[model samples]
Target: MLDIQSLRRDLAGVAERLASRGFMLDKAEFSRLEIERKLLQTHTQTLQAQRNSSSKQIGAAKARGEDVSAIMAEIAGLGDALTAAETALQALQTELDALLMGIPNLPHESVAVGLSEDDNREISRVGLPRVFDFPVRDHVDLGEKFGLDFETASKIAGARFSLLRGDLARLHRALAQFMLDTHIVNHAYTEVYVPYLVNAESMRGTGQLPKFEDDLFHVPRKDMEKLYLIPTAEVPLTNIVREQIVPREQLPLKFVAHTPCFRSEAGAYGRDTRGMIRQHQFDKVELVQLVEPKDSYATLEALTAHAEAILQALQLPYRKMALCTRDLGFSAAKTYDLEVWLPAQNTYREISSCSNFEAFQTRRMLARFRGENGKPELLHSVNGSGLAVGRTLVAILENHQQADGSVVIPEVLRPYMGGLSALRPATD
Candidate 1:
């Protein structure tokens, strides 16, 4: 959510930045509704004040042992009007909130003002792609040889699902465990276990609900219609401080959670149809941070580097892209996407996405910190895929495959996998 004051103060400027992301703010309509809301609010308060004053007069008259019936009648007359005004005022406020929630965050000044991923600037490419001796097979082809079955997974659970057997399945688990440990131990992030399911309000806090429902798996509940199934741990982890006021000393709060990320992939039906790149459910070790607004940008760089360290340790080749404004998500003021090289696909694909949401999410979550000055202020939020487990596995399979049909495990994963160097085809 955006700061309503900023929207009211510089609506046009905010709209222009959002335009790059294909979100257009209805400035005139918002302004008109806001004006109506203000007028109704003021009128309601005035009527309330009048009612209070009349009540005091009635008390005074009764104390004097004089007739208070006429004053009582006047107060009764004000009741109907007061009720109507109060109802209208509440309705206007609700409308304003809905409008504000739909608006995307304004891009930071440092964010590139471009329209799409293709226009994103490449900040750096770390590690070099390993040279291959033979024709490289994609993860899908390689998995088929090693009992990574998609056909059975699809028949059982529908498309974009995979079932790994023996070493491959265990390797995936090892990857997530390693990633989570690295972020928590070496990077100063506190490990957390968050809810796999969250309410709609939780989704909205992370900028996923009101507009992007199609991309989520919503579980129905009785009474309130609250949704469930978290798309990422970012939802639950960052919302921990929702409606909280932490001390300034706790300004930079870092959290990492290894959880199963669920996505409906509604609009992504035809894309990445093969392999685990696009799935309804996948393992992800996510990183989240809550910090003072002043430290957000610097924190973004540090956070991105923290994610990069995983790739470095694993010796995976990856590149960082400074996402263009148009490429930024609804909740992010600025974003960096870490794309890892996939030898089979012969291209770099997103393995991680780190973003600085500034105070966009903090406002919605009501996450604030008590400043040194002792005033409550919205804290900035940042989250990233420490790395996507399935994709990292895909990159590993394709990049490290030998001509002999064995997959060489990355050196860093050796200890986690009980020092096994390679995965060979298992005999029935």
Candidate 2:
């Protein structure tokens, strides 16, 4: 949430910045609402003052042993008017809050102004796509011999789902474990275990609700608040500091979690339906950090490197991209997407997205840290997928596949695979 004062000070300036990202500020409506709010607030205050004065007059009349009924009646009428005015003011404030909540975070100045992903600026590329001596196959074709079964998965859970058997399943698990271990051991992140189902407030704190509700999977209750299946570990990890005020000593709090993510994929019907590229459920190792506001931009670069460490360790060829204004996530002021090379697809696809929210989320969450003045200040939030386990697995299958359809395990993942050098077809 932006500081309301900023909007009041320069509505046009804020609107122009927002326009770069394709959001149109309703200036006229906001102005009308603001005018109404001021009038209602003044009227309410006036009535309150009148009632107080009338009560004092009634008290004086009683003390003098004289008639006080007129003053008493005036106080009663003022109380009724105050109640109505206060309610109107409250309703108008709620409307304004809703409008602000729906607005996306303002992009950082460094973010390029563009309309789509194609306009995103490339930062750097690492490693090189391996040369295949034989005809290459996509993950779907190459994974079948190793027990990648989608038909059974469909019978069990419908389309956009997958089931892996034998070593193929282990590879997926190994990827997640490898990512978790890497971030915990080398990246200075505290590991956490969190619930997969969260309340609506948690979703809203992370900028997922009240706007992108359709993209989430939720569970309705009989008489209680509905819970949502987290779309990423980022949701749980980042919300740890919700409504908290940490000491200055703990300037940076880093957290990591490996969890299964659920998404509805609403409005995305026929895209990437051929395989596990896009699924209803997938595993991920997420990284989150809370830091002092002044250090957030620097932390963003370091955090991006932390995620890049995983891809580099696995020897995956990937490129870092700075998302343009229009392509930025709803909560992120700035974002960097790591796209891993997929040999089968003959292209690079997003495997991780590192972002710095710059107090955008903390404002909504009331997440704060104590400053030198002993006052609370909003903390900046940063989070990214150390790596999406499913996409990493897909990249490995397509990048490391041998002519015989076997996959050579990346050296870093060997220990998790019980020292196995490669995955072979199941003999069954």
Candidate 3:
């Protein structure tokens, strides 16, 4: 949520920034609502003062032993008017809140001013895409020879699902474990276990609700409250401090979680439909940091590097790109996407997105820290897919495939895969 004070002070400036991101702010509507809210609040305050003054008058009349019936009747009439004014004021406030909640976060000044992914600036590329001696196969074809079973997965759960067996399944699990261990040990992030199903308030705190409902999977309970499936572990990990006020000593809180993520893919139709690249369900090792505002930008760089470290450890070729203003996520002030090379596609695909949300998420979550001045202030949030497990799996399969339909496991993941070095096909 934007600071209402900023909007009140300069709605035009805020709206203009929003326009750069292709979001048209309803200026006329906002102005109208603001005017009405101010009027209603003023009217309510006046009525409240009037009611208090009338009660005092009635008290004096009773104290003087004079007939107080007339005064009592006047106070009753004032009570009715005050109640109506207060109710109207409350309703208008709710409307204003809803409007504010839907607005995306303003991009940071450093973000490039552009309208799409094409305008995103490349920061740097690490490791070159290997030249394959044989015709490259995508993850699907490479995994099928070993353990990737799509037909069975589809039969059980419909499209955009896959079942891996033997080494392939172990490799997938190993990827997640490797990421979690690296983040916890090397990155100084506390590993947490969170619920996969969260309440609507949790979703709202993380900027996932009231806008992207269609893209979420929700369960309606008998009590009528809906629990939403997490689209990423970032939601749960970052929200750990929701509605909390941390002591200054805990200025920087980093957390990591390895969890299964589910997305409805409501808007993603017919894209990457052939492989695990766009699965409905996938595993991820998420990284989240809550830091004092002063340290947030530096933390974002460190956080992005931590994710890049995973790709480097796996020896995967990847590049970092700074997302343009319009290409930034709804809650992010700035974002960096790490696109890993895919040998089959002969191009890079996004494996992780690191973002500095500034105080956008903290404002909504009411997550704050007491500062040196003894006042509570919002904490800035940073998070990223330390590496999307499925996509990393895809990168490994496609980039490490051998001519005999075998996939060589990365050296770091071998420890988690029972010291096995590669995945090979089974002979009948």
What's the TM-score of every candidate structure?
0.97, 0.95, 0.96
**lDDT (Cα) of model 1:** 0.89
Task: Pick the TM-score winner.
Answer: 1
lDDT of 1 at 142: 85
Off by over 4 Å in 3: 52-70
Off by over 4 Å in 1: 60-66
Q: How does residue 167 of candidate 1 score in lDDT?
A: 86
lDDT of 1 by residue, 305-325 (tens): 999999888888999999988
lDDT score, candidate 2: 0.92
Residues 331-355 of candidate 2: C-alpha lDDT, one tens digit per residue: 8899999999999889999999999
lDDT of candidate 3 over 217-286, digit per residue (tens): 8888997887999999988887899999999897699999999999999878979889899988999999
Q: In every candidate, how many clashes are there?
A: 0, 0, 0
In candidate 2, which residue ranges exceed 4 Å CA deviation?
Answer: 49-71
Q: Candidate 1, residue 313: CA error in Å?
A: 1.0
TM-score of 1: 0.97
